[model samples]
Target: MKVSKEQSDANRAALVKAASKLFREKGIDGVGVAEISKEAGLTHGALYAHFPSKSALAAEALALGLELANKKLYGKSADEAPDLDAFLDYYLSTRQRDNLGGHCAMAASASEIGRQDEDVSASFTEGYLEMVRAFENHVAQARPELDSSSRGLALVAALIGGVAMARATQKSNPALSKKVLQGMRELVDEAGGLGKK
Candidate 1:
């Protein structure tokens, strides 16, 4: 009749994980609490036990997604610098483009975030700013001449926009989708001064 602390924590994690994946694959509005509970192998009542509402769960899920994406982009450790060129290569590839449920959260839900509640928007904004800070720090070290803040903002925007556009057109215009990815890659590389010695 009772649950252990460890079990409760695990259940909460499962709920957030399931919500993150499902939200990315299907927009937040498109998914229901029952589906997320089923995906997590928990009951609908269990979801409410951890989260007050679906929006609360969504906020937590988006935060988790962003954290995971950041770790994937930059390495796990904060001291290590991100390889901009390598990052571009992987991010722009069709593999990432086609992986809707596992790719960046920003790209997957950029259009939908504006319609969500403040908590969701706050999570999205914080995640986005964290990304910009990572880029800014990298630019400061790699190219002192360039404005780190400006370049950082630009690179993040380009990356998110690039992926979003590529995915959007992938079904209707495959060639254009490919071109969008390619163009954004070039733009990011040039803006970052990626390959210069």
Candidate 2:
């Protein structure tokens, strides 16, 4: 049967969505195009029609997930914030950490990114810089008097690192996850008061 254009588009989206979940759950190397196609409810050939290679699928899925996360976590950049403290609080919240696909591309896929080939790594790098830009924008707006560039770098580095540490401790000690988040949150408070690291 000939598939409608709408159906074809849906299939392509399904493949990316399914691959996004799988890539988050398992490292990119741990999955194959055949597996992703199966998960998407399409044949492997159909999968190739949308994405020529597994790396292509991974890159697209990673980009999609990051775009979704920026909207979900930070909302519009126009409604900017200088409130690094509030951003830290929300970024490290329980809800944010618990939602794997919904939370962040980097936090969910950083380990996989390191293991990936250069193409995927390049995608990851680009997405990470976009995140940094957004964070820096907020920091600069929130505190024009402060050194916004360094503060932005510190804030983003600390939050993402906290998320990574929390994820690592999830199975071993769930309590530690909260502690790491809380510690990072307090770091903002500490920095707000002192010009210290």
RMSD (CA, Å), each prediction: 1.5, 3.5
User: Tens-digit lDDT track for model 1 on 1-197?
Assistant: 89999999999999999999999999999999999999999999999999999999999999999999888778777788776667778878999999988989999998999999999999999999988887788788778899999999989988999899999999999999999998987787677766324
Question: Which candidate leads the pack in lDDT?
Answer: 1
lDDT of 2: 0.75
Off by over 4 Å in 1: 195-197
The estimated TM-scores of all candidates read 0.94, 0.82
For residues 49-152, what per-residue lDDT tens digits would candidate 2 score against the true structure? Answer: 88878888899888887777666545666465434445566678877887765677778777668777787888787777766676666556556687877876
